[model samples]
Target: MLPGLFRNASRMYDCTSRVLQHYEALYRLVGIPEKEMMHSIMKNSKFELFLMKVVQQKVVTGLIPLLNHISKSNIEVDLQEVFKRFTFDNSCLMVLGFDPISLSVEFPKRTYEKAFDEIEEAILYRHIVPKWCWKLQRWLQIGQEKKLRKAWDAFDRFLNQRIASKREQLLSREKTHLEEAKFDLLTAYMMQEEIVNMGVCSKSNKILRDTAFNLIAAGSDTMGAGLARFFWLIATHPSVEMKILKEIKENLMVKDDKKEVGVFRTAVKADTLPSGHHISANTPIIISLYAMGRMEEIWGEDCIQYKPERWISEQGGLISVPSYKFTAFGGGPRSCLGKAMAFIQMKIVATSIIWNFHFEMVEGHPVSPSVSVVLHMKHGLKVRITKRSV
Candidate 1:
């Protein structure tokens, strides 16, 4: 059993312990063991086309403007913040059928954005401090817990408002007319007649909110964080960056103008690992991807370097590594559903930025990992951008 600290922190709405099962309890659409929702949202080929369209729109409407402003002014920009807002707006459009304009020049503040940040930070802190310490603070509703409560309220209110608006809009439209409207993931879930057959309006509402919450949170932040790290690493290693740019040009034909940027499963089925390691048949095994990625035994002598050549085969095509060795997008049935979408988004943004501009890290700006579920730059990656001279 775990300590009381974790046990107490688990009570918070922001807590994400596997034991909660809120997704399952709130709605069958999200919780269905056979992945019925995934079939509609991801497994279908139509979803792929939908994601492609979204990526194109985001690049043109959200990213290009930012680029134009940067190119005109020739000023340093915080790539990390830009990526976060870009992804956030994109995710909202894909999931909620709404764009918050988070990527605009003003960087207008939004309550939901604040809420998400607060909740994530509080949850991360819970993992660090003693259980009783947070528990006592939570009981008194003071410190971070108080902030969490306020954020939780704002998050709930924002979602509920959006749900009500979408519901009203759907009801007002004729069935045939509704088909012409863009379909976001939440709309697909809400329109599922099966979700309605399960019970009354209140039950449906709970499920809708839970489903929306999960999808929105899941689709946010992570992709952008990865992009930031990828760019930072690429920028620091000129050889690697050049190789990546050359590969992109050779493969996608992206020109010099672009100064750009940027798992799961378990089973105890086998008694012996392929490495000749023996274990009891039912023994639980956990794979540490972090460790596996750096192991010279598996990756050869240059495992530590950020080399893009390692990914290219002799045939000049991308080499495919076994899922076990590269657990980035994960593997098997539980692999990331948004892997393709992420690739498309990253490709579009990274290629555009790299060809158009060159990034120089602000001198002496420390870059380190933040303590959170996602790997983010601790102080954020501060950089100066200049247009690439052809």
Candidate 2:
């Protein structure tokens, strides 16, 4: 659904458009055309670099305060939850231009955070059940759908509150005739009613909310999930862990004892298959990247193995595989616009953890992929963290 919606020429079907129309009045309003406009704003190179700097700053500041506690403690932590909270906080800061303080010592509860969780879980559950089942429940206002409605209300309230606050700030600044200094993604969208030539309005509370939602959806747990898997796989494979550590130390000029989190920092052109099959525009096509990465035919006999060495060529220039075969970050123009940003975040987080702590999987701990839009560990990644001598 994401890929198809991201297609350059894709348009919403009457049926899907009607479904959105039914719910539009109940939530912040945004439509297909607005979605395309937001996509263009995201793909802007200057905007992306701004976001990259935002993320980098967040990672450094967000993690430094947590290190002392983590490194001093020998107890196991739900690393999965840690990253999720961290990413959530970071995403909020980047998207809303305000911090929710979700990563505090007490891990304080906030309405917006709870609402975000509820809405995401409800949406994922909707995907799992039969469409008619959820739709009927929605109509009847019962069960999970009822909960979903409440969640949506809360979510909208949060967005509206923030939008109102930002608007007030902008208005006050206008009275003073101050320079427009706001640089958050949401702020950028709010400043522009439209790119006249582009024929799209990026303004409105509804559009602001929608753009923030899209950025969070793209920026949050997807990276956390990848980080969790990377840690788990490396922990389970000593050789792989050693190789990663070696590369981090020697290839990248990262010091092993840095207290600060180390700074880091595609569209399908065709509807036709190689087999002469045609995939209609706006069709919901599912591509399981998990399956693709391990496919024997595409990745060779040892595709199942966790071998980082395979990625390095004999000449040591780094092996390059076609993007389609290595669709982890996806392929084509619709491919993840944050591929580089993700790598930077992951490396900084990964290197910091590996250098400062030894991760030991809890004995008999069960680990499997959770069934969600993002692939997280089923029962969470349980591991003891012991400080390493650098």
Candidate 3:
């Protein structure tokens, strides 16, 4: 029903032209041929510093005040909403060089933000209902189909406006100092287009719009939901929370620290299964990462338990599990491009919040996964916040 970024012909599923487009626009941001350019961009000192500054600014100006208000009012706050706003603001700033300030203390309602949630929910509806049923709704423009249409339009307008603005700025601005300035992803795309004279696919504004939308969509909501789940798990397991806190305290004192899927696949050629099951060519397969993670064979008897130590080595360092085994950020060639960026953002936000506040889940509040494309909390995570004295 909805085919903006995730389902578009030029999206991740296409293994040919779309993949090349992604490599040119996203992986080779600066017109460089480095295989790891995207990861390098995230790790660059300047980029890391820029991220730190943005996170600190948001926490000081946005999050702290909101938490203070919630504490003073003694009311339960839906942490899911808060994280969504926070990550949305950050993603906008990082991707488009614009700050919507959606994460303010006032907690204002934003139509554009609401559009994202609507789009995700509608996509999930499309999966559950019969394809013909949704097709009929799309034909008639009724129900969830109607909402998806509006949401798609909203995304188009918002992204088109930003792309136009960035193009104009690049045209009017002098080229001498462009190399010295830090460029957002949109800026980088425009610059790369100028240098490489990208192919017809990347030359069009549609590609840019789709790329921007995909990055922002992937960055904001997924990160927000993941953080909410992390906090929820920590709050429910006191030992884990305390260990995190203790690690933070010790690291601060030492002054040194380091720190999905409606997924499917289609077979191109005839192949034999490793488990002795054979399939013909052009077979479509659905892989469930959730089920894989819970399998006793893969994760042992305690796979269902929430144990952070599973990822820790005997030497106290992180154990590297193959991407195919973990499969959260995806595996193999089409793995997530934003993995490094996501980790940096999560660490900055998680550490700041964990150190500065203590979260207690509201008693008797229900917590379960939402029935959507994104793994959002169904009823939202309701919690009481208290300021922590460091």
**How do the predictions measure up, each by TM-score?**
0.80, 0.78, 0.83
Tens digits of per-residue lDDT, candidate 2, 1-390, equal 111111100110001111222234324355555555546666677666666666667666665456447657666667777777778877776677777767654667777678776776777777578889999999999988998899778878887887777776665656332132355567656555434536344366775666566666567767667667776776787776666566667755765455544000011443875768776655545556666666788778987776666666676655666766666655565456555556556666766667666687899999986666567778988887766676
lDDT of 3 by residue, 112-223 (tens): 7788778777876876798899999999999999999999899788888987877666777756434433556667656655656653214467767766776687678777
lDDT score for residue 68 of model 2: 49
Cα deviation of 135, candidate 2, in Å:
0.9
Clashes of each: 14, 7, 0
Cα misplacement distance, residue 34 of candidate 2 (Å): 5.4
Question: Cα miss at 136, model 2 (Å)?
Answer: 0.7
Better of 1 and 3 by lDDT: 3
Query: What lDDT does model 2 reach?
Result: 0.62
| Residues 85-195, model 1: lDDT tens digits | 888888887777778888987877898898988887886677568889999989999999999899988988888887887787666655653463346776665565436
True-structure Cα RMSD, model 3: 7.6
Which regions in candidate 3 have their CA more than 4 angstroms from the true location? 1-45, 174-181, 198-202, 254-261, 275-280
lDDT pick, better of 1 and 2:
1
Summing lDDT over every window of 10 consecutive residues in candidate 3, give the lowest-scoring window: 1-10
TM-score, model 3 to reference: 0.83
